[model samples]
Target: MAEDRSEQEPARRPGGRTARVRHRILEAAAELIARDGIGGLRYDQVAELAEVNKTSVYRNWPDRTALVADALATFSADVAPLRDSGDIDADLVDFLEAIAAALSSRQGRALLNVVGAAHDNPDLRAVVDDAIAQRLATLSQRIKAAIETGELPAVDSHLLVEMLSGPVHLLVSRGTRELTRADAQRITSIVLAGVRATAAQHTIALAGEHDGGKTPAARP
Candidate 1:
């Protein structure tokens, strides 16, 4: 019998099987969470849906919170991402459009349901908080960069994000109609204009205070 060199080789490349299993598990978990609130998620259901062993689920995630957190984190990263293309107007428009699209997606609705139910579930609340924080961090960094580069006014980045995303959420959640590119552009334009105007007013106010509450022409 010749030596079985094939048997000596690894069954699969390192991390390949593990990655696939994790992906499937996460996807099944999201679907289940979307269908049934986090309270209804069961390891056996996840295992069966994912086609993986129950032990694998437990081996990877010791508790439901960890599993849900990872699933949401993955969903946020995949579905809603903010990009910086050096054009603040276009970037903001694209970002608003992405948010509208995501909010209208299946997973996005799932996330909204989780948020609605989070008030009663401490574990779910924490998971949602963490996921939201991760998203805001990326958006905040981009807004701050724009401000530093003189592309945007000196405004609270978080507040700006809220103003920009608020309407999208409202429109999508209403289920009345789909958000259009024109809507996104209009939202971006209005918010940016308001921010710039506010910044200019603040600058004018500061200059007046420096001039002992006198206008530029009145100073002389």
Candidate 2:
């Protein structure tokens, strides 16, 4: 059986058709990566899935690594962006919940697939790293907002985000259990408590430093 892009797609983009084609091809590339992992990707498959000419795919991304990189980057950038909804607890829970959902999804598997293959593919690895860093940058801003609003004390935003994300990533990737809302609540509560405790410890240390590093005298 022969697959025809024209037969599969009846409609066409009106303006900036080249851009539209690039987007469709990239989307198809992402889905293929999700379904078959990076090693299984084929240009013809991407073209057929995208309903564009195979030449279009090649023209847009001559390198397979470039194709895969663009696809993953575009997909991650399009995922839901985190927002500070005035409640740190609620927002953190919501954010974690969203992350759990993503990790359990096919796209999440595709992302992990790319990450797993990154060691052997330097170009793809760099693209994936850039994408992840960009996402964490957004999270860093949210943490900053929490700090400025007094919802959280001065803490390491990157480390805080890491603490908040690492456990969930490990659990989900290991297939231990699909995280539920309850899990979200538990994780959020524990991390917030730890953050507060750490902040208190830092404050105490600073206070001691101000006292010329001397032990505070006990008033009888």
Each model's TM-score? 0.80, 0.80
Supply candidate 2's per-residue lDDT for 79: 54
| Candidate 2 clash pair list | none
Error of 1 at 73 (Å): 2.2
lDDT of 2 by residue, 88-122 (tens): 88888887888877766655667777887889877
Give the clashing residue pairs of candidate 1, or none.
Answer: none
Q: What are the runs in model 2 whose C-alpha is more than 4 Å off?
A: 1-17, 212-220
* Prediction RMSDs, each to the true structure: 5.7, 4.6
What is the lDDT for 94 in model 1? 83
Q: lDDT tens string, model 1, 74-110?
A: 7567645678889898988887788777766656666
Clash counts for the predictions, in order: 0, 0
What's the CA RMSD of model 1 in angstroms?
5.7
